[model samples]
Target chain A: MPTHRRIDVSKVGDVTVVTFLDKKILDETGIQELGAELFSLVEQDNRRSLLLDFADVDFLSSAALGKLITLDRKVKSAQGRLKMCNIKPEILEVFQITKLNKVFDIRAGEAEAIAAF
Target chain B: MTDHISAAGWQRTFELKSDRGASRAVMDVLLEQLGAHDWEPSDIFAIHLAAEEALVNAIIHGNKLDSTKKVHVDCRVSRDHVRIEITDEGQGFDPASVPDCTLEERLEAPSGRGVMLMRSFMTRIAYNAKGNSVVLEKSRAAAAG
Candidate 1:
């Protein structure tokens, strides 16, 4: 499994919580690293449910959005699900504007996300 | 369709290779410039995402990730708005032909979502006649009271 630098992976009662450490997701290297690590966690770590905590993330580029959409598809194919929480208002607006809000299950916070899973 | 440098403002031009790696460095400098102007966090997020999408399109779609091709980024920041022009050295396409990613039928498709996001976040988005260059604009402040 690849080591992720931009995202911190942890466990919350059998639910995998990945927190973004960077405020911006514009870096190509960071985006690739996050994508690779999350895929590995879902496929190899036997983690079926993921809660992506975006507390530290303030900005999300389209490239990063594309990666998330792809990751969501992969997790679903594996009979797992992906949920996002703690998304900043500005960042959430991006999802809303793109109507990606309908694609992923988004919760308000860690507690809500954990409860959902 | 919009002029990038019509007034006195912070303007910079970066000549970068088509490699996607160059976008990070470019975005860093551009973000720093916006920060220096004390742009609000919400406006900063919108400008950053719009700029990132344009740069990625220039490198990947316009230049086809051909390292030999060069991407030109011209940026201008003012009190009221931010304008970024990304031009690539490759054959252009028709911006009108991009599919609407918001529709349910194409929601899962990845290629056209970037264009849609760019259009959504930016106050105004325009492509040059050749479509190889895109101009993205974001308003930093609400319309004059």
Candidate 2:
């Protein structure tokens, strides 16, 4: 089953961390859910920096990558930079193959990723 | 069809149908199983994208959306790799005859992204002369979880 375990958006000093604890992200339906959640997060929080921790994510789909692009754009629109950390190498390749790697601030680990902004 | 699967480690099989929704779901399930065996999310996405394109080709171009036709999804997973077999009940086309998606002539259009994505994600993807099946394989580092 596709599960979203947790999503918390909190500010650490001036940076915002949107932690997504999930098992898998596949199909358009799941992407829609994530898109909605992220849209709301951005709308309510005017904060300009966001972080996505995929420590719990086991899988991702193109539909999900589409949503990630959407999130990156949304954050950038707010003058905030969006970064992803703890992502598995395979998933990172998805970003690369799709050119999303160039689009998003993907970090090898969280601490370095968060500090980039 | 039963003989196609039943190995250990990780494996699952599902019958594909005319429904686009079902095809996508089956791909998701297979990839999730692969992920449980430590496949990376990026690699799974690549597999999923390739599977999507292959399935769409089977439904739209191959079978022409005939409800009577079927697509079979067979997948196997291990710590370092995942392999997928998608079989369609239609007159298979030659993968070689298709135009490359990356070519400058075709880049302006939107239709050929599927084959390109498939080839990009998996280490190996091949089509048999029977044109009834496509096999996709992606080799990558195992996920920590």
**lDDT score of model 2?**
0.69
Clashing pairs in 1: none
lDDT of 2 by residue, B1-145 (tens): 3423334456777776766455665765775676776665555566666777677677667777788987777777777767888888888877777676445464333244456677876788888888778898877642222
**Total clashing pairs in model 2:** 5
TM-score of chain A of each: 0.94, 0.85
Q: Give each prediction's DockQ, rounded to 2 decimals.
A: 0.66, 0.13
Residue-wise C-alpha lDDT for candidate 1, range A90-116, written one tens digit per residue? 888888887889998999999998999
Candidate 2 similarity to native, TM-score: 0.62
**Ten-residue stretch with the least lDDT total in model 2 chain B:** B104-113
Q: State the displacement of the C-alpha of residue A42, model 1, in Å, after optimal TM-score superposition.
A: 1.8
Which lDDT tens digits does candidate 1 get at residues B20-138?
A: 67787677877887887678766777777778888888888889989889998888887777888899998998988987888898777655777777787788899889889889888
Cα lDDT of model 2 by residue, A1-117, tens digit: 123334656677677777774566654455677777776666665667788888878676655665776777777788778888998776676566555666677887878887888
